[model samples]
Target: MQRRRLLKLGIGAAVIIGVAGAGIALIKPGLVDGKLGPGAREVMRAAAQAVLSDLLPSGAARDAALQAQLARLDATIAGFPAATRKELSDALGLLGTAAGRYALVGLSIAWAQASTQDVQQALDAMRLSSSNTRQQVYHALRDLNVIAFFTEPANWQAAGYPGQREIP
Candidate 1:
């Protein structure tokens, strides 16, 4: 009876190990542990849309719109599984940095293109902004350029941007 009990215990341990290994293999393709789980990408998309909405000219209407958009995103993401929700939340935090910088770049670009004194003043003021602010603005501009590159095939072709070219 003792021998039989020992054999059952060994079989149970082997089954547990095999299940664990299979689970890891299936869930972690490419060993990327921080992969955005199901539904997480959708949250990121919502966040991006919110940022784009917020970039509209600042005013009471815009403020209200931004708040409404954020609320919508929050509600939509609230139903995701905890692990996926956490991943989306973390990605959103990183995206916030990029969004701030993007906003700065958009503003800076607008200022640079303006022919009016008010816009020139705003641009000049932005030029004198703190180092951190400047970095955010510049980085955002770079990210925009990159995003735009991939967004349109024509734009990519016009720029002669080869996404992946094999070398000899």
Candidate 2:
């Protein structure tokens, strides 16, 4: 009886999440015609701050770095195949919405208003969630931020990677 109840609860939760994700994707997609729309950028910007809290600089430099990271994120996501891009874009769209944020990220506040600490805590929750879906979301967001920030040539040095040398 307990197992049956748990199975029912899991199915119910999955359905709710699917409906919410689909609604967000239809109402306000994160990407459009291969472009990184505002919705996607908002989610990426917030997630980057959370994932790179320690690595990102402080004060004005941090603001500049975040802006640059968003640009990098746009370019990195653009390179993904259409299907993959669409899936990621939809996930970002879901995260950008208020209901989606509360459901998936555990954040009740808007991304624009969320402090780094708030976002970090929410991400930590997602990382530790028993739900595999939430865990996947955590990894995807973290990996995306890491990839976007590290892809810059200037950042390569900081990560201990010297630029490629020209072979004679």
Candidate 3:
């Protein structure tokens, strides 16, 4: 009976450790890579275009700025807490899926294929959505995009902020 009880206890301990390991793996999925997958990156690019359209110029300049901004965004995401990273990862993954895209953004087309106007409309709807989840997702993307856009020194001039005053 003593040997049987010890074996049962060992099995239970192994099960607990297995479950915890799986949970941690789920929470940190791909975070160590420090970059978004292609589909996720496309979604973020479309989102940035939609959110910062007024600030972003048309043509090659806009594309160049967007690439820099995405790099900044990726760096920012890489430093986020595990829970925040997980949430953002989950949201991005959902945005990449056709069904999730339609459900969340009301668009049948893939995010990369969606027109600027269409992407803007979808983001606007999300911003004004009654659902808390939708609004949260909108806010997260919007905040990231705005931060990435305004943090660039080139944009500071446009925003009317002179270079930092040197402290003597």
- The C-alpha lDDT values of all candidates are 0.41, 0.86, 0.77
lDDT of 2 at 49: 90
lDDT tens digits by residue: candidate 2, 1-168:
699999999999989879878987888888877766787777888889988888888999998999999888888888999889888878888887888888888899998889989999989999999989889999999999999888887887766789899999
What C-alpha lDDT, on a 0 to 100 scale, does residue 118 get in candidate 2? 90
Superior candidate under TM-score, 1 versus 3: 3
Once fitted onto the true fold, the runs of candidate 3 whose alpha carbons sit more than 4 angstroms away are 1-32, 166-168
How should the candidates be ordered by lDDT, best one leading?
2, 3, 1
Q: Which ten residues in a row have the lowest lDDT in candidate 2?
A: 32-41
**How would you encode candidate 1's per-residue C-alpha lDDT over 1-168 as one tens digit per residue?**
699999999899867754653444354321123433333332233323333432433567655543444344445445557776554444333323323213332333222233334333433444567756544533433343245334544434535676657888
The residue pairs found clashing in candidate 1 are: none
lDDT preference between candidates 1 and 2, better one = 2
TM-score for all predictions?
A: 0.27, 0.86, 0.76
- What is the TM-score of candidate 1? 0.27
